[model samples]
Target: MATHLTRRGSIYYLRRRIPLHLTEQYNGKREITRSLGTKSRPEAERLARAISVELDREWQAASEAAAMTAEGKGKPKIDPRYYDLAGAYELAELEEQHAAEVDELHADADRLEKLLAIVERRREQASAGNASKAATISAEARKPRSGAKGNSVSLESVIELWRRDRQPTAKTVDAVTRAVREAGDPDIHAVSRQVVIAMRDKWIEAGNSVATVNKKIGFIRLLLGIAKSRGMIDSNPAEGAELPPPKRAVELRKPYDPEQAEAVMAATAAMQATDPAMYWLPRLARWTGARLNELHQLRVEDVQERDGHPGLLLTNEGEHADGVAMALKNDGSRRWVPLAGPVLGFAMWAKGRTGPLFPAKANKYGNVSDSFSKRYGKLLRNVVKITDKRVTFHSWRHGFADMCRHAGVSAEVRMALMGHAEGGGAAAAYGAGDGLPPAMLIDGIKRINGDSA
Candidate 1:
């Protein structure tokens, strides 16, 4: 009798020759033993001995079975479900064997199909919860009067509508127009998900931060939402689109410290004596933290006393020489910002009754850029020690916000002062509260003036 062994698919096989001496019924179950690996025939014989030992141990345990009538059955009966479980385990074992052979092909079609089914089930479960949360947030955002006005239109159309309706001071209208034009193509209705993703990739390629891309995408989403509401599109493609993850928040620029502050004041004082119009512009900015356009548009009548205290009134509409009426950036932006002592002093010194606070010849908005840089640039450089970070006219507003934070002003008070629309439930319920109570403005003033109290 000769025996042979072979391997196939990680399985071992053995063939045995049966002797012809006995009758076929008593030929002793033609041996077909599986191989355990061995280096030589003696090693193979040793493995065979181990197998014989195991079999004898099993026979000893089953000696009682031979005494029972049930032992006459050829094989034990197996439940159908047991076979099914065994088939599943066998399939799993085969898959593990296949995985070892094809390592890179793990996520094949079958696996993808199973994964998709799980994902869809999870999404269905989450849909209702997400919708409810969105509705709650939208409802709260609509509570304030400013919020209502703000909601009537989107931020995309704010400048266009402002220019059309409000005859804003020429400088203001121009500035807003530039901002709008720079934001170009407000109709992002045709922007696809792939387009947005590409745009984000391009931004990253250009070395922009994820936060920067997110900010632009946020504005893009706002535009798309507005376009949908206005019937410009049937759907907002930006909705449900994944945005790039934001980076850590950066610290905001703060107000100049005392020595730096003195340099700015000294520069303004010197400029006041030399170039009065240019000097008063930055002075009012530092004093009021007003937007550049706001300072540029000031008229004599806009500065007045309310209840024996000086206040500045702002309107969306600016009068041309011909007296045409127009709306401001939005209805919410038409509210007044109170003027403190420094702002009033700067206004009085300028002494303009019916024209711009820093009046320029027609079509000369950009002309003041050089004059502005010359006056405050050096002083800001000396103070901040970084020429790039030197105070711009816009920095006044940023600096004022920083001062407010340093003074421990409440978020509500600071937001109201900055003309930000309230979206919180409590803020919306209370409304604007008759124009940011004078005390808060006074407190803001004291902080800027370096008053300890």
Candidate 2:
């Protein structure tokens, strides 16, 4: 059974035959085969184990489904619904009508028929015991249940449409797109609970944090919701999928202490000549409590003097001006964070800065924050020698909030300065308070920096 692992040109793959009794559940397929997406044997083994566990659970569910069907009939029964393709013409006609030109309409219809043919042939081959031939045709090419709006549409297409309509963060788009690709890019109609569960297991096995796994799953759930709304799927596959509870509250991230902050600032100060982000971003985070991305994505124009005080204006306006799309977490994230004090060095740092205050480059996903996070993490470990796993770059923001509390800043003032949503209440809805007056913010900043007399 260990031979369930195979290699093709240095890439490991999982190849396991369907259990004889379970072939009925797997559309008469004889095996499950998919790339492990890793060249390392140890990593492949871990992923394979995850896949095996999910498959076992899938087989158990299939057995239960089979049992239910058998009890209702004189003999074992395969669901006739899986084989129904009556909506093929209707779906093809829908696609054809969407095509702008006569030539394109014919071409689109032809393409739809070819996809349908592939589905039909896969079923025929599987039923005839030509398992390998059936496997050669993608198992994803199934005839969707007849008479749905988007029965013939691929999940890929649906995802693209959602992206265009919603405009999620680049990181989100990238993560969801990668997750779907890793899951073999099944069509909307083929995305089942089993499929979602299997992908979740694989992510867990790959050592993604609970939060990371949940966030990616959330994307799939959103996509499926869109599918259901558009008649691509009858229901969301991601519903009711549970995950392990998050880390305990005691183990959650804590704000860095004064000593730790001094150490980080001093260490980063040494790199000012070469890596400006290391020197400036920490100070900005400490002073403003702004999220990391907000500080990292700042432009020279964003730094200005408002009401006789220097501050950074965080906004999603002119996003992608630096080749990476910047996102404000919400409308509240767009605020003017006044400089706490001139001693924090923000005034000097912004004096001559032009495009993109930080020099750190965006990765392939059009993000600079991840790069800075990694560099800062390494500094915490190797340079600053702060070994607390819970204390990282974000701790600065936490520390800022804590300082605000100590400074006797009101909840509204603190939340406004930090760009957090004011909780629901009459106070939160007070008129024209979205942009706090500079005099009040400056006073709060002075109190936070312990400069207020």
Candidate 3:
């Protein structure tokens, strides 16, 4: 039979009347009905075709049940609970279809008269344990999640709350906001697992890396988990989204040789007359082995004494002049990096300022490492003629690490100084020296400096 659409209130439903021949054997029900769950007529029409296919499958099941009845061949006694459930779905379908009609089904009649309770319990049973496992096995599973779908918060509101409370980077907050807005901005509860899978596919098609795609998906999952914790969504849509296999690590950038390093340091001297931020940032990175953002975000106050020797404090806890927030990449990234001999000279050059030492290079996110990065890129490529893309500003940090390695510094000492994460096992937990001594860091730098000279 051809499927048809009918509206009860604003929601469209899929309905197909049972043929005369089947009505007598099919529990005397004259029509098959299910909520299309959407008001859009076009979407409802497309969904009607799927419900019609479901109705065909139900007809096959009913035919088998009827044959068993006719031959008296199947299980002799059927459980009343089974038919009771069908009655529940049937009654709810009836009520939604006839909402304008009488409201006199007495509460004393039966507990299942609460049709919503039965439907909800059935949904819970379907989703309890193995179903979650099944969802993991498949690329996508879209079904009625276990929660009250009646009340839902908007996806945009959830993102705003997450950003405010979670305090991710401005760049990170922007990326997540853009990605969610791109994913159609449905209510948080309405975002099914299939939607998350589709987003993964869309990002892959647009040429994002496996790492980037996974990170974006991770952000979505993390946000949904927050929503779930607050009872806004029943489940996280991004829980089992697939990711590409891990990519092989590539070493794309290398530090300058002694001659190249000496030339770059000399160029910074000429630049100091025009722009001290440009001059000092690269020079500090050369000696201290700090990330560009770490150096760029430093306040004058960050340069202070460590064990009677000058050191640069790299941390997220500083009280900036404008009070813009800051964060380190990880916990280990917060430490006091001792200034070497060359850096002590720059420290004396940069003392007595209460604000950022590189205020001119600062931007809205609190660090304009990009400004310095671009400026240095030109110097390295156009002027110094080191055409390799790998040997940019970051290469100076690499140059320091290489110096540490060539000086036979211990792995743990290098890691601690660089603010890398604690290494694996009991070693990371138990082997606690407060930090590397200033003299060691100085020694590592002096060897490199002497070589360049």
Candidate 4:
């Protein structure tokens, strides 16, 4: 049986019919009760449904305790069949739910660990591959032989090397430097044909003559040759580059006839009254078939007058710093050019003592042509119908040589006077002086200047 009471509009229950002493000995002398808070009996009965389940669990626990006590009395005890169906079922279900939650948490941790490992392995492989490729590329780039390594090998370096090793004339060096600086890349091993061709086109567009552009290309070719020899490049790209052929055939500007020569001499003399230096330079060139450079480097000491007989001494100091030694254009140009009569008088009148004979403000031979052209180019062009031609001071040598031929000078004498190499096998074999004697050269000059032999 169970006891029931109503308090605060709620129903309460307590197990009954057991003595207080038995209850204290069997359970713990505490009241076993449950509350069902409701206003009506029906509602209270409905709320007391869970109380019945708690009462059953309490009854079973007490019965188990009494049975264990009886066993301890050393007497055979009867087993009681009792079950707390609600409590047992509810506890079993809670344990199952806890186990399921633990299993799900463990599976999630394992999946995340595997994903992290895969990502780490992929990153390592990618890094190693990139490192290997970088190393290979670096090695290949360094293997090729190039001009003086590092960033310092620049266009300036190329120009400096040309200046030091090629020993080019100042004009030649300046022209080459200008072209190289303007047309080539400093880091590139050799200049490309495309770059050179483009430069050619640009020069032509800028109103430069084909001959001038060709000359510039010639310097670029020389630079490429040096670069190739040094293993800076595998090949010379400019080797196959095309340039415009020289314009105005060489034969068009033929030698002057005797009458034309006389007229030129008269024209030159008449122009002397205004510009003496300009006038005398061409006169001396006509009298002596000397190259423009030879005349520019002529000195007062080189001109010696012995017994009223004048002769020019040609010296070859073999590439001097100062223009003291007379280095001929080639081996054939090493011979002395004899001076006499008007030519001798002209040389003496130009320079009295130890200095350049035909010294211009700029002593270089290249500038002398420019100086002459600026002053008398139009005048000469008006006098002669010299069209579509680039004429320099050296044309006077051709004029003088042609004049000698027309004046009936022998071929041998002409060759000797012009310092040309003799072609005869015997003279070449014996190393005989192929040049004329000083007296004969003086006699030849006199003949050309309208004097008797």
Residue pairs whose backbone atoms clash in candidate 1? 165-326, 165-327, 166-326, 166-327, 167-318, 167-326
**Which tens-of-lDDT digit does each residue in 38-135 have in candidate 2?**
44355567778899889889988888887888888877555765445335533544454344235444765997799669756654654433443233
lDDT by residue (1-453, candidate 4, tens digit) is 112333321222322233333456546553444444222233334445556566667777777887788789876633442235445544654565456446646865997698558745654665554445433433332343444333424433566666555444545665776666445333334234545566666556657777778777777777766766776666765675656566644653444445655655677776555666566666667678777556655667766563467666544432222322344454556555667466666655645555665555433432333455555556556775444344545667787777787778777777777776667432532111234566666666677777844
Against the hidden true structure, what lDDT does model 4 obtain?
Answer: 0.55
Backbone-clash count (model 1): 6
Best lDDT among the predictions, by candidate number: 2
Candidate 2: C-alpha RMSD to true structure equals 23.7
Which wins on TM-score, candidate 3 or candidate 4? 3
Candidate 3: stretches off by over 4 Å: 1-143, 146-150, 153-155, 187-193, 207-211, 227-263, 317-332, 352-355, 423-453
Best by TM-score: 2
Residue-pair clashes per candidate:
6, 0, 0, 0
Q: Report the candidate with higher lDDT, 2 versus 4.
A: 2
Q: What are the lDDT figures for the candidates, one per model?
A: 0.50, 0.70, 0.66, 0.55
lDDT tens string, model 1, 25-59? Answer: 33465444555432123333455556656654654
Q: Against the correct fold, how does model 1 do in TM-score? A: 0.47
Q: Estimate the TM-score of every prediction.
A: 0.47, 0.59, 0.55, 0.50
Q: Lowest-lDDT window of 10 residues in candidate 4?
A: 1-10
